[model samples]
Target: MIRKHDSLIHQILAREIPQYVIDERIRNILNFIKFGIESGIPANGKEDEDNNTAETSAFIRQLADDAIVLLKNENSILPLKPEENICLIGPGAVERRTTGGGSASLNSYYHTSVADALKKKLGHDVPFAMGSLIAKNLHDLGEVVTNPKGKGFDVKVYKESFDVPEEKRTLLENYSIDVSNLLLFDYDPKGCENSTYYMQLEGDLTPDKTGEYSFREQCLGTAQLFIDGKLVIDDKTKQGLSSGIFASPISSPQIVNVKLNAGQKYHIKVEFGSGMTFTARKDSAALVTDSASILNFGYIFHKTDEEYIEEAVELAKKSDKVILCVGTSLDYESEGFDRSEMKLPGNQEELVSAVLKVNKNVIIVNQSGTPVSLPWIDNVPAFMQAWFNGMEAGNAIADVLYGDVNPSGKLPLSYPKRVEDNPAFLTFKSNNGQCVYGEDVFAGWKFYEKRKIAPLFPFGFGLSYTDFTIDNIATKLDGENLEATVDVTNTGKVTGKEVVQLYVVPPKTTTAVDRPLKELKGFAKVELKAGEKKTVKIEVPYKYAASYFDVDANQWHAEKGEYGVLVGDSSSSEKFLESTFTLEKDELWSGL
Candidate 1:
């Protein structure tokens, strides 16, 4: 390949480029090729083997259990009793989103959904309802569709356009695909790698319930869905832009609803054109090129968001307690794109409000990697942040919900009540190809503290099954190092863990430079038994504890002042144990 593109490479690199740089680049590429040759590829079957072991599973479960943050436990509704009739509700309850999308996505060997895990622990199935549809696109048809051999679609490739008659089209290859979400960027047909092609996917979709079924189609190129020889959705000519695959501007998803009977099979056919046949103007922002095509086809028994919420409310009314599992998944939260808003997707907020009206014993468990605004937060009795925690997410969440594991996680960042409260709200997006960092150093809790704006939940805030107290705060300074020690005790009957946070409050500056009210310098997590006290010491260099980058001086400056050391479980000011230590002189340094 290098030899083939030799002239083109030379044409690009011959001018203005240093010879040594080009030689180094070539050497690096050769070394990478050599490494690949020496390593060799694994055996076909071994390459995809499941690598998870029993110990690793247990460890993962433990990590998930500890990472859960109990944001609110009003009236102590947590540590749920086993006898309570618990009802699991929402899309997250049934869907196993073990990871995010894009590069972070993976095909785990096995995963247990929250509904399944809870059912197993209760030794019986609980009343469950999908309160809302959080998925941006339609659900895949893999589970409901099948072919003569088994579950899957029979796919065929042709070196012709969809406009051509089936009899006149030249067939290139045919295969069976079990998944409807197909990414064929690297797919090369026997004789059609460099030519335009089309694909046809055929399967039998058997419905489990009689209802209005909705079918949705989205693709990188043009596509159309046909049910029993009837064209249902035409996504070819009337294409709009959408953030679907790779956060690219692909053809917007088109949907069509059809009535179907329970236990009855319907013929499903999808005609897909290659990326080259895309009708819409090619978008440079699209991560996928026109080498191949991408297709996502899905169908589901239709139900209105209101109807789903009503069903969930009915279930919640009868149950002694409710576990409202809700949050963004890979579809709405991923690497390729940023969420348009901070609210939960779909009518989830309405679902939460409706459920809360009927059940006060609801424990809302949100699973997401980032913070989402909760409008009904004040009314809920209990809330927990259970992030997308790998394969053992369900099992670990069940453990925490049932008191088998006490949550010890703290909020790493502040949760703003609204998107408008965010520090970067004004200049968050690009303005004519340039983005301004308007917030500057006032990011995270720093902005909230400096601006005197109270966040929904401050940084380092978390609730434990047991209570803890931090007292007897003392500070000492030795040279450039400052150490703060505090006594943390578990006051409640249950054993729990406490994170002792040490925040440094810089003295009022004499110059024009502004500083935050306080900044977290160091922290220590301590496990304490009931009535047990432990002296946790957190030490930090004075420069790191109270330094700000002096951009003009090209150095970090620690102002000479009496720095206040505040020790607390959270960043909230009211919970702190304060003390003071003087730096005596200003210090400026560059390298770390």
Candidate 2:
């Protein structure tokens, strides 16, 4: 870092420069950067000799315990007895996917696996079976490439597509690049900021088996793969962002299956697009960064599907409670791409069905950033949604399973029974290069309620080991706000927390503008001991209960009408208490 400029006032004494040239903003920025470098903030990691200190680890694990959501529990089947026979069955049990794939992945200094967590909690060795392998059958292109240096495929960057004439094409760069997996990130092509560019990767593939070779492609913008002059993977469509923050692909890969001879040399070519004609894709709201295009490609095969299913069934029959950890990985569901389907990947559905036949005491723990279709949902007795819980995922889960903690986290969004049932289903896909939000106000829970479509699980739904009841709802007008109070009582035999949600149901307006059935106004999370009672008072501004976005006037206006204050645990659940309030005048307001 540069030393502070030898006193500015002293510089004027030597007449080196004029005083008017001083810029306070530039001076402040330089000072800040210099301070950061001199302070050694980047080297602060050295302060902690052991990254996973007991104190810090316990804090993070508690955070996970607080965040995990329990979607379903029938007859209090959770909080398993310490003496119960427990056997882990599934690839997820031992796979130890602490975080989803892609950029979110971390080399956690200390991480716990689900199998290990269970054993630690129970103080006994946990038996685990590799019921069905969650293996990707694709051949690693790194090992197959013919580069003498043993790096990556030969790559060529072009200003035009492969269809362009070779003589007219402008070559950018050509180099040998190697990849362990198919993800491509952080390649900066000069003069290509917020513009479209094409890339061709030349490689050779030698299959290990003489069977139908299938390839899948998932891209941020668009890409196509050709195998020996024939197009095997065509992903030219404008893709949606799978993740909002990371700009992941919203769609899964489209498969192309063909028979090929084993150990035969096959030429591979890939064509990628970075931008879509200056337009945004409809499936995603996030913008695609010109930074790098993540092109993930892989092959698929399941030679021993029957054998795997049989082994899982045998284990399910022997176990008293089956904790089926099934869901998508970061590779399947990430920030860049939205999933093409809601169904679980590979043969997970088949495995679940076969296991259900032999055992009814299955507790399905579905893990994903988003919802997935559960065709076997009805067959299971208990279900939980354990989102990406970081390094303490297993330990946090064991806390809920063993009664160390009660699950209180609610669903932030509705879980549709099928992807087709989503309100934006018909218009969710990008048309050309744009997505239209035609659903308007009817998004998420509002759409389901408006269309009378029942979701598998409604927004704000969660189960606790102990039960709670709400009563004694009362309301009053306090200046420009409505203050509502409700009494929440824990009636069960154990201590737990209950989220009291306050919903506002506006009266049918005399005007023609249609309104949603109800909107979530506020909520309060109350914790209590068994038989404990507490009053939670929530404040809802009059604007929240009476206002609507006036598109014609470009402002939010409130109507003078009667509004019903409905309180409940979730959107679809029965209202615990209902009270009405009246707005004396129509009010218009804006700004947050």
**How badly does each model clash, as a count of residue pairs?**
0, 22
RMSD of model 2 against the true structure: 11.8
lDDT per residue for candidate 1 within 1-592, as digits (tens), equals 1122444467567675577777999899999878877787643434444557898789888888888899999888999988987889988888867888766777675777888898889899888999999775567776458988777888889988778898998999887777677766656576775536889999998787898988888887789888899998999868887755554557877888899999888899999987767777465335454464678888777999889999999999999999999999988777657778998988999999999999888899999988997999988999999989889999988988998888899999998999999999999999998989998888888999888899999899999899888889889987768989888889999888888899988786536477777889999989999999999999998889878899888899878888788888889947789899887787789888
Q: lDDT at 129 for candidate 1?
A: 92
> Against the unseen true structure, what C-alpha lDDT does each candidate score?
0.83, 0.75
lDDT of 2 by residue, 291-317 (tens): 435566656443467876787788777
Runs with alpha carbons beyond 4 Å of true place in candidate 2: 1-53, 98-110, 133-184, 187-303, 510-512
573 in model 1: Cα distance from truth in Å?
A: 5.0
**What TM-score does structure 1 among the candidates reach?**
0.84
Q: Which 10-residue window of candidate 1 scores lowest in summed lDDT?
A: 1-10
Q: Quote each prediction's TM-score.
A: 0.84, 0.69
